[model samples]
Target: MPSTPLFSTYRQGENRVTSSMLAVFERVGLSVTETILARASGESTLETVVFTNQHSTGKGTVPDARIAADFTYLFEVKTARNAIQDPEQLTGHLQLLDEESGKKTSKRFLFVLTPDPVRPQIVEDLADMRVVWFNFAALHDAITEVLGDALSAPSERDRFLLRELQALFEAEGLISHDDVVVVAAGIAHAEYLENSAYICQPDRFFRPGLTHLGFYAGGAIQPQIARIHTLESRVLFTYAEADLRKTQGRNKARIGEVIRWALDTEVREEGEEYMVFLLSGPEDADTVRLSAPLVNDKVASSGRPWAWTMSQGYTSLVALTRPGVSRTSDLKQA
Candidate 1:
């Protein structure tokens, strides 16, 4: 399926794009105030505010900033899917600012905000100027870092706005911060297991929630409580080796069959590793307890072994856990 664009149709205009840029700057720890919007195609408040000391020039230019007693930023916003049309326009704006300010002590930044990534040549052309190129992904990262605390808080309003911004960022083909957290957590968990599990979604472009996890085991596994510990987080769960034959006879053949099929296919593929988590419950249940096996030497050494495949390629396992429910077998029936 084609992925959804990060920006909506209504927000594709230059003005709306510019407003979004300002919102990001303000939200991302920048002391932005005393703002002005462009009234027409050529008339912008940026030029007026920053060029107060110089004579009027009919050329339309946007100043990166000129917040009184604060800072000056000149921003040019482009929502195009292609490269910038005219690089000289940005340079011209900078020249205009230089003429007006004439070596003033104010800090100036030329910002180019675009939905699409720019070419290397574009960066080279603006190398001498105070230009900073920000595509949607880069900008999203900045906003996420700045608002990390607010995004994690329980405030409904803050979360709502954060989601809106995240949606916008995702629409522009950028991964949301929420997905990043989940993936990062999953990676840390995988690493802590001594590389027993492999992360599925390593690419930042794909969205992998917390449930997308896979593991590797060498032999028959036994039921045990395993804690997936990462640098910053930990998740504890009871793992048990699944009995496919028993599951097949219980009208849960589809899931069992899939797991069996994946195990069989994964073993045949050279150097391929895959794992499966069986989630069994009512379709509408709020939570379901998951059970998977912890493969260890003790379980492998046991003579009466439960045959589970080893090696890995690609597989996904997901099981739901109910609050206050500890045992996997204690999962409530649908």
Candidate 2:
């Protein structure tokens, strides 16, 4: 027989991990509803939520439940280091839920508190079992979306709980603080763009070594915070269809054309180099690609380039970065 997996061993011997998982669910429910406290009268709040771990049934196996009502969810919480050894495990839980409820209504979900993305095969296997996978980052995104602009409200207790949750997520390698801030700023920026008469695109791209953050309205690479300064900066390059003399030089114009086209359309290529054009706007009113190194160099060479003034509308950026200095502020000071 094969050796048991580490997760199985941990589950059999330890209750603390299970307790923590339950706490995560509880905190998520609380944080999601914290904003409702500020809602106007007559505005409805979320339904009374409940999270129960290791719910008991008359049968040998028990499934997690909501509010101790009939089993409505089967939750398998995994720590950062553990991989799903048996995808069929969820199927067993599903069977147990069916046996207990006599009708199929319960949902199965796997909560991975890891920073890394789950393996595609594992995801597929879970899907086969009718199980939804909610990674830590996805959970954070859901919570943030639920809170909306109410995040700006001065609720220190709520903020502390959120920070603590984020700390746990970070320790498990779910996300970095910088990533959280950037995402928050991006959400705020997207809202700002929508309110400012710009059609913000839903597509965004971010990965290591990418020179730009992600695309926004008109395929603009909107950086949340600048590593160099808060002031806006611009780099201009003109492309003419007639200027195709040098074959090597034609690449720049080709790139420029792609950027222009991406603004009007969607570009979904992966990797670093192509991401620049993949997230740029049209040539007429081009969007700036906020590169820290380039911005720093511009600042060092000259006292705030004249083109910097062309970049504006950082209201969301300012709101997100307040109470703490960010790259945007750093660049402004520089």
Candidate 3:
């Protein structure tokens, strides 16, 4: 087990992770730091925030030797999702960033890191350019990708520390979004595959941090999963009801389209309520086909393949990719 005494404190639950992140960025060098910053801010912000201002000479071009620009990145890490609703917390952070306007700060950003799969409405509605919202799973992916590129270089120490940082995040369960919901998509499988949307009763409880959606059809689980559209934002709509119950998750017009689509598909009847999951668009990369379709092949005492009877089941990405995992029974919840 990897452990560090500097990050073993409880001053703030997320402070340990935040401190560890800064420490790793400081030790691992500029590439990893700039990659994460570029992700949180924007790719075009690389020259403005992370690098020195280049000057043009009379002959050709010249790069500044000393790269010094006061760019500040403040992180607010949340292990849970509820704290994002605190208006005072976000307002205070904005005030802190505003105070730097008079200083020599070329660029400043307040990066909010949460475990939520989707950006909360409160954070999304903030009318500030300094605020950048990102989730932990994305952060892990960005770091892992940058480090992968760095592996070809001679920076062994950098790779070792960064790998430790990745391990620390995993140990804290910040990026462990392997859990998936395998639901029976009987009649609406094609509709969902085409529209990139899924609807169910508002009361249907899915575990927090469920990463993927696996459709079960044709007596076997679908080879692909809606991984890219992993619960982007969910909105609750009551058909034939004038008043909307929860309308802050996604765009109102888009919600209306989904409601109309549900009606066309007969998934929601008149005066019925449904929660529509806004999946990613039907692009080639939106869903991932597994190595092989998971089918019910296990034999029972009666010398026949056991039948799958559940409308829904839980599994993990690890289990889906594991060898010899052919039956739904092998997909134990992680």
Candidate 4:
């Protein structure tokens, strides 16, 4: 059997991604569009835009009025972080938006979308308030949340098109699905139980696409897997004692105490560098514990416990949370 592709094969990567996104927005109708725009721009102007599709007598009618936007939203899509660094492209787009936005009280936005977690330094330094920078992850989240709403009553066609867009995003490496990385808790097990954070060497890297962190202790994997925490206003920094004390305020002294206990050292070096992973549980809680622990049942033929040598492992959320998954080996990936 033969089938037609949802998006064009010969188009450029950015163009294809952009087209898929626009097609989904158009097909899903006005609510999704207004919700996304409200979230991206943090503006309430979408509420003021009146939409009607009925007769003068308030009876059901065909297209009494068409949905429209009072403002303009120009999207500049880039496949890679480096591609969006070209100042000329942004300047040209902003100039055109400005020309089209003349003598209007309504707002105009030039939304720059990229695959990077953060916008490029050029976009960050832009003085124009009309410019907004966002990543594909945010778009994915917004779309998923909107479609998952039961009250919104999304149609089957809407679901199919949006799912296709998500598939495209995953294929292009624009987003990563949730996965778990289980590592040895060691001395930091206590820290996890209390403060809900894990610290490791700065050079150590986890497997790609991991969104949650799990701990292995006492010949078993811990009950809970925590979602990695993020701060919108904070920049990345190393976990140095001096820096943490100076910048972390309130939690500084407590963090130092915990670090001392974890390291089991008397004199702490000021130059030590570690990457801190803050953890958040359900409802943004400080701690999380599962009903039961996941144990390692891989044993020798003689019925004695085998030598466990799991430093770290990766598993999907579906496998980890399944009811019959009792052994650590069942969830751990090679």
Candidate 2 vs 4: which has more lDDT: 4
User: Taking the tens digit of each residue's C-alpha lDDT, what string does model 1 give over 159-187?
Assistant: 45545765665665433222111122222
Q: How does each model score on lDDT? A: 0.39, 0.37, 0.66, 0.66
lDDT of 2 by residue, 97-213 (tens): 666566444433233233333332455645544444545555555445444566455255555655565555555444432221122233434433332111222233333322222
Clash totals, every prediction: 22, 10, 0, 0
Of 2 and 3, which scores higher on lDDT?
3
lDDT of 3 at 165: 75
Candidate 4 lDDT, 1-334, residue by residue in tens: 2133456564788878887777677777667777865665455555636566652544554666665456777888887644666788888988998888785766678888876544556787776777887777667766777678787768888888877887888798776433667788776566666666677666576765556778888888778778765311222332455346555654554455445544554322345656666676433542334567788776888988863445677665555664567786765441
User: Candidate 2's error at 33, in angstroms?
Assistant: 7.7
Candidate 2 off by > 4 Å: 1-18, 27-71, 105-113, 149-159, 177-334
Candidate ranking under TM-score, highest first, comes to: 3, 4, 2, 1
Give the Cα error of residue 7 in candidate 3, in Å: 3.2
Candidate 4 has which clashing residue pairs, if any? Answer: none
Q: Residue 192's C-alpha lDDT in candidate 1?
A: 23
Best by TM-score: 3
Per-residue accuracy of model 3 over 1-334 as CA lDDT, tens digit each: 2234434455665878888777777766665677766764444465443444665455776866445556666778897644688767887887887786657546777788887655666887787777788777667767666667654352777778777877887888776555678788776468677677777666577776665677887777877777634332434444533135235444454566677666666666756666666565545454556766777654679998664545677666656765666766667532
Model 1 spans > 4 angstroms off: 1-14, 23-29, 32-68, 117-120, 149-160, 172-334
